[model samples]
Target: MSQILKGGCYCGGTTYTIAIPDKLPQVVGTPHKVPTSILDHCGKCRKTSGSLFQAWIVVPKPWITITYKYKEGSGGKLVEFQSSAHGTRSFCGACGTNLFYDSSKKKAMVEDMDGVVYLVNVTIGSLDEESLTHVELVKPKLHVWWDHGIGWIKEAFTTAGQGFGGLAKYPTGDVRQSPEELI
Candidate 1:
């Protein structure tokens, strides 16, 4: 069965509920650690977010849902950046919240085969782990772009079993359906 997962921004100005599909498509990329502060590791992220790295999950676009009313704030709507010609990142205007990072550029970018759509990654600091314990379904699988990560984060979660769990040996070759089944 499918599940409804709810999350929102820091000020509660925006709220979202995503209908997670029961099956996740198999992912095609091999998990690798990279030395970078942000996946979209560039000057834009550092200046906008005032942080070294932005926490993100690389997922397909179809899986994301942003509340219509909350799409923008008093500052203005999120200015999407074509980080690369193929990827996009959305950031909040008012508070500089790093909202979403998606690789889907357009319908033309979508692939024919079934695969995991998007990353359901949330801001580690933005979320209250105790409150969302049950809903905190997925942990960081492979810490990509480790170069930009805060020094403390790596040192804290690096312990083998402390901050990791779920599947043994992780999934391989693009998910065939929605990750809802695993949840």
Candidate 2:
């Protein structure tokens, strides 16, 4: 059975629904192969979210529907930013809530043999807290851009016994200093 998940922006300006596949793929060791969710620590994600890491839910683009409203009287609308030549990032223009990341080029390149469009990534933090009871189903399977990750992030995950074995390390050196060490 497919599951319907609801989410919106911080100011309730943008709302979305996502249909999750019943038979989600298992968390695999390969970063590109994992089919559920992933945590990103790349410079762009960190700068966009102002967080050390951002959790994203990966699903087929066709599974999502989004609507935007400016205020009580204003009609629905959406604002999108072309983050890269082939990638677009959407957000609530009114309140600046980072909402989505779409890579049509990536999807096109990965279309199935049957020519079906593939997946897109949405910020997991945008979902309504109450509607996230089944969040475990979308728990991040791996951490990407580990070389750009903050030291405390690594330490926290390590302390929890969920070390960085499944991490995707970029060539950039680890630049983050742990707060504890600084204190």
Candidate 3:
């Protein structure tokens, strides 16, 4: 079951669609990890997003397309910032919305298929409301760079000897009681 996730920047200046295709055969030699979304807790991500962690919908460069426009009707690509020697972060200049992180440089390549270099780590929060509900559909299977995040973040998300003390979970917007309350 593949999905097309739609997203845009705060001011609607930037829009994109991520087409997640169903799994295919691994024809490339050597080990390769399937392209799945991820929760990145690295310091750079946190600093760039001003969030504790950043949820990324990882997609091959070919599977996504982006469009952006300015206030005066100047449509252009995202403003790319080279945050690291091998990586870059792109955002909408109009509204300052962080969009994607690219790490296609061969020097920093860790997991990629043969001839496949670029992967867009799309900011999940930028996705539309309907796409947000399809969180499970994106298949964000890994939590990476957690060691660089705050200590509590890891504890709350993982078993970590203690049970989940993370963000409280409520089924809906209101803080309504569950199970017995409804019954």
lDDT (0 to 1) per candidate:
0.48, 0.73, 0.74
Model 3: residue 106 alpha-carbon error in angstroms: 6.8
- Per-residue lDDT, model 1, residue 45, is 51
The RMSD (Cα, Å) of candidate 1 is 13.1
| lDDT for each residue of candidate 2 in 1-183, tens digit (9 for 90 to 100) | 777888988888789998666665432333353246789988888888888898898776777888766666544355788877888888777778888888876453222323545568889899887656775656787888898998878787877556764455444566375434443
lDDT of 1 by residue, 1-183 (tens): 755445556655544554444554344453332111124334555455566655543334455466634443366445566677675666655555666655543222223335434443444344344424533333444555566666655665676876444433326666665666545
TM-score of candidate 1 to 2 decimals = 0.52
Question: Which residue window of length 10 is worst by lDDT in model 2?
Answer: 26-35
lDDT of 2 at 150: 88
What clash count does candidate 3 reach?
0
Q: Rank the candidates by TM-score, best first.
A: 3, 2, 1
Q: Candidate 1 at 156: error in angstroms?
A: 5.2
Q: What is candidate 1's CA lDDT for residue 91?
A: 60
Clashes of each: 26, 0, 0
Better of 1 and 3 by TM-score: 3
- Candidate achieving the largest TM-score: 3
